[model samples]
Target: MINNAPEVLRYAAFTTDPAGGNPAGVVLDATGLDAAAQLAIAAGLGYSETAFLTPGPTERSFAVRYFSPLAEVPFCGHATVATAVALADRIGPGELLFQTGAGPVPVSVTAGPDALEATLTSVEPHVLPIPQADVAEALTLLGWAAADLDPSLPARIAYAGARHLVLAAATRERLADLAYDFDGLARFMTDRDLTTLQLVWRESVGVFHVRNPFPVGGVVEDPATGAAAAAFGAYLRTLGETTPDAVLTLHQGHDLGRPGRLRVELRAGDARVRVTGAAVAIPADVA
Candidate 1:
């Protein structure tokens, strides 16, 4: 129903600097828009995904939906951060609730000396083993040999609102080369109900380099992936690789020239994960 640009707010999640994180589009109010309209806008913007928020005055939360150019996603982390930061700018920094298709997500925003930072606590996360056959197929599509994989970090299907296949690379070089079979991987992901392939390479125990192949979303890669970070936190816990109160840092988008950082926090006695980052506006005229 919005005939114009609808005041799209741009933000780069996970990094304080505008140049160092994943950029997302946030439409704070899209209550009247339909699926087709949402898709059209996302496609037009062409930013991996866009988040639409519908306010519910009576309720403590707002209805939220995520749309990629290709389809609707149950949840999207970077977009959520972007939306939260956008809302904070208007409504003042505070706690906000989002009712997504996956579940209710609570976000908190705080004002920093330089900029505002937002933290989102994910829904309960879980991890599942990836089938060997599927892993082989995915590896083939990505042109990655078995030796390129990291044995320490096993392949898994992790879920925190959405599902992503976590494939850890043996080296940073292997993770940087992202040329893959777009249509083939897309088909493979669709068949398995996967949102993306969370390609990664661990730099250290707490630091990692990552890339997300989102062919299903009609995007080549996601700069900073909040959902995948949450899932990866669960994946690490399931592997018994990290302590209960561990914090992981994910660096992404450097390969694509839009480098961003995502901070993931895991707490004891809580199945949910927390992802924190900062966002900034991308001028409508520029992008």
Candidate 2:
């Protein structure tokens, strides 16, 4: 168990179709791989992120780590979802707890006739205001002007497991056409310890479209971002954009030709946001 992991599995989260969602590599039994080996494996897969799991006292619990293409992240929502569903496929769906660097995350998986779905409850979420200067600088990197931002949503840094700047576009067109200065944005994010910019546009009362620029992860863009979705839900709840108890739907990756959907739920008394979606394994041939 030193160098050789039991198996390396590839799965896509937030969508039932492997071709639609964000892809992640999962090692269900990574009992011996160290941080360097984990980083190498994640980089080799070339996905935005990958997860490694070490068994805990019981089969229902494990210590998990997430590695992006460049570095180790405290947590990753999509990867967590993928791992839970992958485990469910073998052990049958129920509950699984993952001890992550950020905190403990509890995931519930349910097996259905069509696919396996997983819902992950995030840690307590909070929001903080983004400095006007910082927001302006970010906008400049994105090639967007102040007028392009939706005045109603405002701007803030939201965090559930990771931090993301919540910026709302005035229109869907603005959100769809994403071409940013990658290096500049990367520098800005790294300085602020930001994971991705949650560039979003509200389509209606409960539906929204989003795009995430994950330069820090060494990816141009994330087709589907579950962590951002959870953060955005907390942002909305904080801003009174949505009711404290509401279900919101997010559509992502369509602009990249890989469409994925995520469901976000907020409870009245609970501060933790629940992000739910289905994950499917990418066939070996497709990989």
Candidate that would win on TM-score:
2
- lDDT per residue for candidate 1 within 90-188, as digits (tens), equals 878999999999999999999865678889999999999878999999999999999999999989999999999999999999998889999999999
Question: What is the lDDT of every predicted structure here?
Answer: 0.88, 0.92
Extract clashing residue pairs from model 1. 20-259, 20-260, 21-260
User: Model 2, which residues run further than 4 Å from truth?
Assistant: 1-6
Evaluated with lDDT, which candidate comes out highest? 2
Task: Indicate the residue-level lDDT of 205 in model 2.
Answer: 85
Weakest 10 consecutive residues, lDDT, candidate 1?
278-287
- Predicted structure 1: lDDT: 0.88
